[model samples]
Target: MLFRQLFDAESSTYTYLIADHTTKAAVLVDPVLEQVERDLKLLKELGLILHYCLETHVHADHVTGTDRLRQATSCSGIVPDRAHVACADRHIKDGETLHLGDITITAIATPGHTDSHMAYLVNDDRVLTGDALFIRGCGRTDFQSGDAGTLYDSVTKHLFTLPDETLVYPAHDYRGHTVSTIGEEKRWNSRFAERDGRGANRLRHRPSFIEFMNHLNLPDPKKIMEAVPANEMCGHLAATA
Candidate 1:
């Protein structure tokens, strides 16, 4: 397998590039519009064919490069089936599989950052957690129809079920840290750490966590007005306007 992790400073977004060793078929996750050229150059230099462009959610922070990527590489644009985006070329549901050569990517609905968010499991080893789970702190659940309780379940129930050694790659990180394992997060996660398996099983502390998140007076994303609507059409704002 071939993998690359790229970062965007304006939005603190992390774009991922993954490819199969045998066929050189590739896919990109959470690409930003500003970094499309860099992503394409890497693809060209590696002699890999772009097969898929995947989105975890319709972002409210920065515009997606999906439109430009599709135009440049002719890759299929995939999003969760429940996403409000009308421009997704492929609508994947939970448990659905996507193939790039022999590599398999499975969609796991992990909403709460947004109603349609999904974290993808790649080849059953690593998981691209998106904004659902981060290195230490999770995404703010104050907007975009976010629910703190659902996010708690997404982590403790769905994501934590993955192998403890599973590598976690998130979509954004304000800190310099780039990667972590499920085991590390389970132990040190700022919000949900220190709970036993049975505690997580009962969501023993989920309500208090949700209540805290609900009461947090966070500010709206800087680009929400522009980014959200543009991203809804795969970042082609004029197409809908």
Candidate 2:
């Protein structure tokens, strides 16, 4: 298995490139539109064929590169089931696995940040937590049908159930961190856990978590007006217009 984490500094988005070393079949997860050339170059240089372009949800941050990439290659565009992406070649459901040679990517339904979001587990060793769980914080539950309590449940029950040693690769990072383990996040992530008076890490209560999230008052993403509608059309901006 070959894995590469690519970043788009403008949106603080992380686009993942995963491939099977034996067959050279590759998939790009959450790719940004502005970075398509770079991704294509990398794939060409590595002698890999782009098999799929996967989206976790309809993004409200930056436009996706799936449409552009598909135009350039023979890759299929895949989005999470229930996503409003009509142009998607396929919609992946929770627990559904896509095989790239020996590597398997399974989708985990985690809908809070967005009503139709997914977090993918790769080969049971690493998880690509796309906008659902970040390095130390989680996505804001203030829009796109987002709910604080639902987000809390998704993180505490669904994500936290993974193996403690499983590697967590988020879709975006604003704090210069790259990767973290499930145990590390469960113990230290302030959004999910906090240090008790006894100096032990404990999960934040659901009600409290909900209250905290509701009060965050985060501003909308800069590109929401264009990104959301465009993403719904599988990243073809003109289609939504």
Candidate 3:
């Protein structure tokens, strides 16, 4: 197995590249359009075949490189079915398996950040959590039709169920932290601590989570007005549109 975690400083986003060294086949998860040339160059230099560009959800913060990568590599574009992007080469449903040579990727429907958000479990060892789960703090549930309660359930119930040692790779982290484990997050995540501070026994984590989410007045992504529409079109922009 070949793996690399690439970062974009401007967006503070993490793009992943995974490949099966034996077959020289690879895929990029949550690719950013601005980094397309870099990603393409890496694939070419490594003598790898681009297989698929997998999006965790319809992101409002940054335009995706899926469309452009497809044009350059003939790789398929795979986005969550619920996103309704319509232009994706394939719409993957929950529990579906995606393959890269000998590697198998399973789609885990985690939702919350956006209704169709997904986290990919790579061969049961590492989970690509997208924006649904982050290090110490989860994604703000105040925008993009996000739901705090649902996100809480998705994390505590679904993601946390993975083995304590399972590696967590999130899509974005503003701070310098790069990775976390399921156990570490369950223990120290401030968002979870906030839920506990509300007295889980009385308010319950769900209600507290909802209240917490409602009160967070985080600003909208600076690029949402432009990025959303472009992402909806699979990250294509006409000179005039």
Candidate 4:
């Protein structure tokens, strides 16, 4: 089991490279468009053939490089069935597993960050927790189909049930922390701590949807409306005329 995690500073997104040492068969998870060149260069240098490009959810931050990577490497793009993206070759549902030589990654539906969010559990130990769970906090449950109460349930019931030592690799982290263990998050995560009434609960005072929308600082996603249709259909822009 060989793995490398890459971070995009601009969007605080994390892209992962996991490979089987014996076969050099690899997969890229949640790749950002800006980093595609670098990612491909590294993969080529390592003598690894990309077998799959997995999207945890339809992103709202940066454009994905799924189509570009597929064009370059002829890799299949994998995404959750609930996501309406245009480039996926395989639309996986919960409990479905993808195999790469000796490695098997199982998908687990974790729908709080988005309606189609998924957490990929590798060998039932390491989890790529998309935007669902972070080191000190969780994703904001105000976007898409997000519901705070539902997020609470997803965290406490689905994710927290993993063993304490299971490593958690989140989709984005601006703080420069690359990875965390379930035990560490369980003990130190402020969001869960607050939920347990052990500390200050800032989320308790959050405004209603209308009021929250009024104060949202985020801009509309770049090419989101366009990306969705193309992504959902798995269509890529042709490189040549």
Candidate 4 collision pairs: 84-232, 85-231, 85-232, 86-230, 86-231, 86-232, 86-233, 86-234, 87-234
Q: Score candidate 2 by TM-score against the native.
A: 0.98
Ranking by lDDT: 2, 1, 3, 4
Evaluated at residue 94, the lDDT of candidate 2 is 92
Per-residue CA lDDT of candidate 4, range 133-229, in tens?
9987677766667666666667667888899899999999978788898877777776664343665333332333224433546666565565544
Tens-digit per-residue lDDT, 115-202, candidate 2? 9999999999999999889999999999999998898888888999999999999989999999999999999999999888999999
Give the winner by lDDT: 3 or 4.
Answer: 3
Q: Model 1, range 12-91, lDDT digits (tens) per residue? A: 99999999988999999998988889999999999999999999888999999999899999998998878888888988
Best by lDDT: 2
- Residue-pair clash count for candidate 2: 0
- Give stretches of model 4 more than 4 Å off: 195-241
- Model 3 has an lDDT value of 0.87
User: How many clashes in each candidate?
Assistant: 0, 0, 0, 9
Off by over 4 Å in 1: 194-204, 238-241
Question: TM-score of each candidate?
Answer: 0.93, 0.98, 0.93, 0.84
Q: Least accurate stretch of 10 residues (summed lDDT) in model 1?
A: 195-204
Give the better candidate number (2 or 3) by lDDT.
2
Which model scores highest in TM-score? 2
